[model samples]
Target: MDSEKRNQNYNTYVEAKVPKTKFWQALLKAFVVGGLICCVGQLFYDLYAYWFPTLSEAQLGSAMLSTIIAITAILTGLGIFDWIGAFAGAGSVIPITGFANSIVSPSMEFKKEGIIFGICVKMFSIAGPVIVCGVVGSVLAGLIYLII
Candidate 1:
């Protein structure tokens, strides 16, 4: 067969083997899962507020975020977060838990390489850009605010 015909045939075969996605179903799952994660964060915030009545709102928020991140890291280490991510897709990915997972997952995977070169280095492989962008963006925003 000629190269053009052979390429067309291969493309057809690949298309036939690909599974069809249920777009709406995936959207619904993502929405529900994301909402549930947010609700859990809110629950933590409420509990913290109740327990530490003298704490400021910012302090309560920090505690809640820390709790969520810690829980997400533990779950990722245990392999449960992978299942949740597979089911919820972007739902589980758009939250702070996803950031926690991004950091912990790589560190866990590279644990065999030792602390310095493996776990510590790889720990921020995925989240490093995110942290950088966030810091840079905040700085720019602060500068803009000051200028105005």
Candidate 2:
């Protein structure tokens, strides 16, 4: 048999072995999990506002964001966040906690190679593109606003 024919047969066999995904089941799981995360954030926001009444609205917002980021980093370090991400799919990635997880996961992964090169370098590998895009997108938005 020709090499091309053998490759084609192998590809067909692999395709047959792949499992089918249920769209509705995944969608429901993602919705529930993501909603739960958001609910937790809302709780934190309320708690902070109640506990520190003197804080301005901006301060409370920052506090809530920091709290969520810290919790997500701790979860990522303990290896629980990945499971959440797996179940939540894009739902998990849409939140601020997801950004925290993205940074911490790589840092933990490369910690074994030493802090300077491994942790620091790999830590930003995933987040660098996101930061760049955020800055570029904001600049473009600002330019458009000025033009209008």
Candidate 3:
């Protein structure tokens, strides 16, 4: 009975300390940030298309994605991306930039440990599972299509 009371008290304390979520505000922020990221990608795509008029659509897309990833990596290194992520929540997390940030962040955090174990290894810690799942899913989808 004493342990039960202590547990109940702890639960109440934790509940009181938790911040309240503002659902609509979060949704709006996410929508705006995500939309802005997509707009930036589109702008890059347009610029690339204009600069390399002879390039195919796939090439233009690849260039645009590369630009976004580079920008995201730079921003993550500078520590600006974390601030944006904190303020925007999932707003900053649903885009390709977020994936870039995930890869860069762990590497930056662990860089002091050394290049091989720290930067190179930790760089993929968050992204490794995601990459694996993406590859597996794609292969499965391709196999299903072939079967069908």
Candidate 3 lowest-lDDT run of ten: 86-95
Please give the lDDT score for candidate 3: 0.92
TM-scores across all candidates? 0.84, 0.85, 0.86
**lDDT for 75 (candidate 2):** 90
Candidate 1 CA-lDDT value: 0.96
lDDT values for all models:
0.96, 0.91, 0.92
Q: What TM value does model 1 have?
A: 0.84
Query: How many clashes would you count in candidate 2?
Result: 0
Per-prediction CA RMSD (Å): 2.8, 2.6, 2.4
Candidate 1 regions exceeding 4 Å error are: 1-20
> Tens digits of per-residue lDDT for model 3 on 54-114?
9999999899999999999999989899988987888888888889999999998999999
Off by over 4 Å in 2: 1-19
Relative to the unseen true structure, what is the C-alpha lDDT of residue 55 in candidate 3, on a scale of 0 to 100? 92
Q: For this target, which candidate reaches the highest TM-score against the unseen true structure?
A: 3
Best by lDDT: 1
Question: How many residue pairs clash in each candidate at the backbone level?
Answer: 0, 0, 0
Cα-based lDDT at residue 132, candidate 3: 100
Sorted by lDDT (best first), the order is 1, 3, 2
